[model samples]
Target: MDTLNSGSGKLVGLSFEMGPIRPPSEGGSYSLLIRVTRNCPWNQCTFCYGRPYDHEKFQMRSVDEVKADIDTAGLLCDEIKNVSWELGYNGDINTQVGTALIRRMPQLGNSHSFINVFNWLHSGARTAFLQDADTPIIPTPRLVEIIRYLREKFPSLERVTSYARAKTIFKKKEEDLKDLSCAGLTRLHIGLETGDDELLWKVKKGVTAEEHIVAGRKVMEAGMELSEYIMPGLGGRAMSRQHAENTARVLNAINPDFIRSRPFTPLPGTPLFDVYMNNELELLSPHECLEEMKILIAGLDVTSRICFDHFRNPSYLNAPGQLVHLLKQDYDGYKLPEEKGSLLEFIEKGLRIGEEKFLKTESYQL
Candidate 1:
C-alpha cells in the first residue's frame, strides 16, 4: 500500500507532521505555510490582495484551528515517510525533500497527492506564516503562545515571520514588540510601499513617512529582522522624485536589514486599478521605473543590503552593493555584468528610450 494513499481521507486544514507550505517571496524562500492568522488586519494598501476570502475585514485563525493544522502536518509526515520507503526511495528522496521534487516525477502522478502532502509536512517547515495582512494586530500574549507552541512542536524553528502595517507597529508599544521578539517572533515584513509622504497619504497607507522609519527602527531595536518591501513605481509619473527621495530618507533613517525592491504592478480591482481605469493615474513604464529606482538607490545612504530579487524588476539597475562597498570606493567599481550601464546612467538612458519591453526575448536568450 502507498503510505501516501493510506491517509487520503484526512480533512483539509487539518494538522499533519510531514511536508512544507507557501510561495517564495522575491528575495527569500517560503516554507510550508502554517497560516496562523486568517486575513489582513489593515486592508487599506492599494496593491494588496488581502485574504483569499475577504480583502477588507481582517480575521484570524482560532488557536484551536492552528493547533489542529500542526497536528495534521505531523501525521502527514509519517505517512510520507512510509510511502517513500515502500517505493525503495528512502533517505534523501522522501516527503522531507519537498513537493517540487514529487511533481517532477511523472510516475508519481497517482501518488502525487500523498507526495504533495508529505512535501508540506517534512520540508524544514518550522516557519509559520501569520495570515491576513497585518498579523501584528494579534495580541502579543496570544501570539506568543502560538509561537511558543510551534517552537515546542518543532524545536529547530528558524523563524516565525509575519506582515504588518507601519501604523500597526507604531500603535504597538516598543515593549510589546520586544516581548514578541523574545517570544521567538523572528521577523516582520513591512510594505513600506513608498516612503513619499504625499504618495503614502494618497495611497492610504495609514501611516506617515516618519511612522514607517520609527516602526522599522523599533523592529530592528527589538532584535527582529526587519524586511521592508519598497515598490518602485508607487509614485507614478507625477511624484516619482518625491517618492524616491522620501523612500531613501526613510531607509537611511532605519537602515533596515533587507530592502527588497518590489516594482509596483497594479492589478485590477484595487484603488490603483480604478485610477488606471479612469485614466487618472499614469503608471511608470518598466524603463521609467528603472530610472526611478536608480534615483532611489543614489539617494540611499550606505547601509543595508539592497535586493532586486524579484521578477518584475528591470535588470538595468541593481543594488550595486553600494551601501557597504561605495563609501570606501566610489561608483566606478559598482557594475553588475547583467546590468547595462552605471546605475544613474542606466536610469537616464532608460528614461530617454521611453518604450518598455519585458526582460526576456529570443535575442537575449543565453
Candidate 2:
C-alpha cells in the first residue's frame, strides 16, 4: 500500500476504484461501494442509452484487481480507526475523527474513495453494494468468490446487494443463484421498467415480461430479496394504461419484496430524448402520471413495499409555496395491501392539487 507522511502521522495512500452509481437506497445507507466490473454489459435501452457510464465499453476486472481494491478499502478503514484512537475517540469513527483525519491528511478531502469509506464506516459499515450495471453477469464461481472475499474482509457487512439484469438472472441456473445467496449477496435491484411487451420492445429493454417474472421468482426461491424498478410515464400517453396495468400484473405474479417507482424523464442525448424532440412520443403530464400511478397501485396484489425513493417522482407545491413530494420518498416506502388505501389517498391528494402546481416533465430534463 502507498503511504503519505503527514505532520501528525503517516497516512496510507487510500485509493480504490468505484463505479458511477448505486441504488439510492444504498446511498441512503452509506454502503461501501465495490466496483466488481466497469461500465454496463448491455448499454441499450433507449431511455438511458448508457449515459451513466458515458457509453463506455463494458470490461470485467480480474478477481485479483477487485480483491486489491477491497484490501485498499480495508486498509483505509484501519487507518481511520487508528486516527480515531489517536484523537482519543477510542477507535470510534465519527464526525470529529473524520474531520481531524482530513485536517491531518488534506488529500483525503479530495478522494472519492476516502469519502465513501469514511462515510460508510461512520454509518456502521453494515452493508455493501457491488457496482457497475450487472454484477451477476460475472461467472457464478468467480462472483461467489468475490462476495465471500468481501465478507471475509468486512465481517460487519450484514447485507450485500447489486444491480442485475433480469435476462442475466434468468440465464443463471438455480443452483448458481443459491451459491450467490450463500456467498452473501443479499439483494438485487432490477429494472423491470415496464411489463408491457410492446413498450419493452419499443424501448429495447432486451427482456420479456415473462423473463422478469421467472428471474424474480428464481431470486426469491434462492432466498435473496428482490427489488423491481417500475418506470411510471415510460409508456408516455399512448401506452400509459397498458404500461401501468401490465407492470402491476407482472409484480403481482412475482410478489417481489420491493417495487420501486422511477418516474420517467426523457434526458437529453438519450434516444428517447430525440424521439421526444421529434414529437414521435408524448410525455405524460403530472396529473396523467399520477393517474397512471393510481391505476398501477390499484392493480398491485403483492405484499411488497412500493417506493417512490427517487427525486424524479412527482412533486407539487403546497399552499405555503414550499415544494412537497406526493409520496413519502422513503426507501422502505409504503406496504401494499395494508397501506394501499393510504397510498391511493396520497395519489388522490396529488391529483386534486392540479397540474399547474407541479413541474412539467421537460423541467426535469438534465
Candidate 3:
C-alpha cells in the first residue's frame, strides 16, 4: 500500500475490493463489508437473473487475497483513528474527522472502501458482512480460516454475517456447518423467494422447498441465527395463494430467527421482466399483494420475527396524504405467535385502506 503524508499524519492508499450488494439490514447496521466471492454461484433465478452483479460469472477469492483485504481494512481503520487523534478528537471517529480527512485527500471522497470503513467505525464497529451473492460455497476450512483471521484482526466485531443459498447449505455436511459456526459466522441470509414447488421451478432458484427447510434447520442447529428472505408477489397472480401458504408452511417447519419480506419488482434485464412485458406473468395489485401477505402471515406458526425491512414492502397514503408503511421496517420486526394477531390486524388495515391508496408493485423497479 502506498502512503501519503498530510501534515502531521499519514493516510494509506486504503483501496480494497467490495461486492455489489448486501442485505438492507446490514446496510442499516453499517456493517464492515468484506467480499469473499465475486458473484452468485447460481445466477439463473428468473426473478433476479444475476443483475446485481451485472450477470458476471462467480469466482471465490483465495484465502491470502481475502486476508490482504482484511489487513487493508484494519490499516484504514487505524489511519482513521490517527486522523481523529491528530484533529484533537481523542481517537474518536465522527463527522468532523471524516470531513477533515476528505478535505485532506479529495480522492477519498469517491473511495467506497474508505467510506465503508469510516461509517463502520462511526457505528461502533460491531458487525461485519461478507459480500457477494454466496459465501458458504467456499471450501469449509478456507472459509473458517478467513473468519478466524477476520476476528483476529478486528476483535471488536460482535457478529459476522453473509448471504448463502439453501442448496449450498443443504449440500454442506453437518460438521462443516458446525465448524463455520465455531469460526464466528454468527448469521446467514438465505433467499427463500417462495415455497411453492411450481414457482420455485419456474424461477430456477436451483433449490427445492425441502432443501430450503433442511438448510434452514441446519443453520439454526449449527448455532447461527438464520434469516430467511421471502419474496411477496413472486408468484405473480397465478400462484399467489400457493406461494403464501406454502411459504408459511416452510417457515413453520424451520422456525428461523428472522422471516424477511422482499416484495418483488421485475427489473429490466431479468427473464421475469420479459415475462411481465410479454403479459405472461400478472403482478398482484397493492391490495392483492396485501392479501397474499395476509395468507402468508396467517399461516405462519413459527416463533421467528417477521420483518419488512426492504423499501419495496407495501406502503399506503394516510388520510392526510402522508405515506405510511404497512408494517414496521425494522431489522428486528414483530415476534411471531406473540404478535401474530397484531401482524394480521396490520394486514387488515392495509386491505381496508384499499388498492388506490397503496403503492402498486409496478410503480417501482429494484
Per the 3 Å backbone cut-off, how many clashing residue pairs does candidate 1 have? 28
Residue-level lDDT tens digits of model 1 in 61-112: 6777777766665565554555556555673444433443344343444443
> lDDT tens string, model 2, 195-246?
9999999999999999999999999999999999999999999999999999
**Candidate 1 global Cα RMSD:** 7.4
Sort order, lDDT high to low:
2, 3, 1
Query: Model 1, residue 26: displacement in angstroms?
Result: 8.3
TM-score of 3: 0.96
* Model 3 lDDT tens row, 1-366: 113243413443667899989999999999999999999989999989899999999999999999999999998888888778767788888998888787768888888988999999999999999988999999999999999999999999999999999999999999999999999999999999998888999999999999999999999999999999999999999999999999999999999999999999998999999999999999999988989999999899889999999889988888999989889999999998999999899989888886898888888885
What does the lDDT read for residue 221 in candidate 1? Answer: 94
Tell me, by TM-score, which candidate is best: 2
lDDT of 1 at 363: 20
Estimate the lDDT of model 1: 0.64
* Candidate 3 Cα deviation (angstroms), residue 12: 6.1
Error of 2 at 36 (Å): 0.4
TM-score for each candidate, following the candidate numbering: 0.76, 0.97, 0.96
Cα lDDT computed for each candidate against the true fold: 0.64, 0.92, 0.91
